[model samples]
Target: MPGERIEGYATDPSALIERLFQQVAERSMVGLPFYRPQLPIKACAFQLLEGQLFGALLTPWMLQLMLLPGPGQRWDYRRADERLALAFPQGEILFRPGEIAPDLYYLSCSLLSPVDPALSAERAVALAENSVRLALSLPVRQTSVINTGRRALLRGALSANKG
Candidate 1:
């Protein structure tokens, strides 16, 4: 059983991300000025779509949007750290690959990184979740022109314009 792998995503990814980053945080990031002790490590709001699993991962050093193959997709583990442009309903997001363990790989798009010390974990989590949800959503209206509001959304901030 130790060598066997489930068809797709058998283990909770939050646990995996937490464990992976926890090691990194403790090992290489302790004295870094950007590391936020209050931010902690967490993975939240993972969603599976069209055989890809994506979610928000928070560590003391950064927050990232993590993407992994769900069921039908397979990424060459050797391609770790290679950047790829992946198509989404919204647009193509650029992802850089990394490893969770031997033969296990994931992709990450940096979100809130070097997290603001003033930012509360609750707020960071909310923003991370919202950013993922918005990133995957199709634009309500297609336009060739890039407006400030839409640009902000594409840049990972929800539109502040309420109207």
Candidate 2:
């Protein structure tokens, strides 16, 4: 919930949609498809976290995540002493490994269906980018990121105490 913000507006959904389309055309290289109610969203809007892209679209329902284009390559975020870092997907991002000191990537939702993390890594950026573009087209009221690192740290401490 770091960069989340809400504002009031009077424009209709369609009008916002048109503006978002125009914005996407101006902001990204991906040629997004026309928006449909049943289609999955695209685009991966990222922000700098400790001098890197720290945020992402982890899932489909998290419509609150910002829309942006992917850099079209993988970014490794581990320190010299660590290989994997705590990470999980919420909305559309994989929380960076350094976010938590212990785990390289924290697991969240089990594979509902077989998910190729590698493939997803590539496709999601596109989907997230599109999704953000679409969401920006609507009358948004709220937004939040899923911080799996924070949650896992609390859980680990509680479990350690119970032991």
Give TM per candidate.
0.74, 0.20
Task: Please list the C-alpha lDDT of all candidates, in the order they appear.
Answer: 0.76, 0.34
Of candidate 2, the 10-residue stretch with the lowest lDDT total is 103-112
Model 2 TM-score, all chains together: 0.20
lDDT of 1 by residue, 101-161 (tens): 6544678898767888889978888878887898888789866985658666656554344
Off by over 4 Å in 2: 1-43, 47-122, 139-163
Span of 10 residues, lowest total lDDT, candidate 1: 1-10
lDDT of 2 by residue, 1-163 (tens): 2232222122222233334434544565233342222323332354433322322233322222321112342333333343332322223333222222221221121121222334444454465455434533434567696667977989989999999
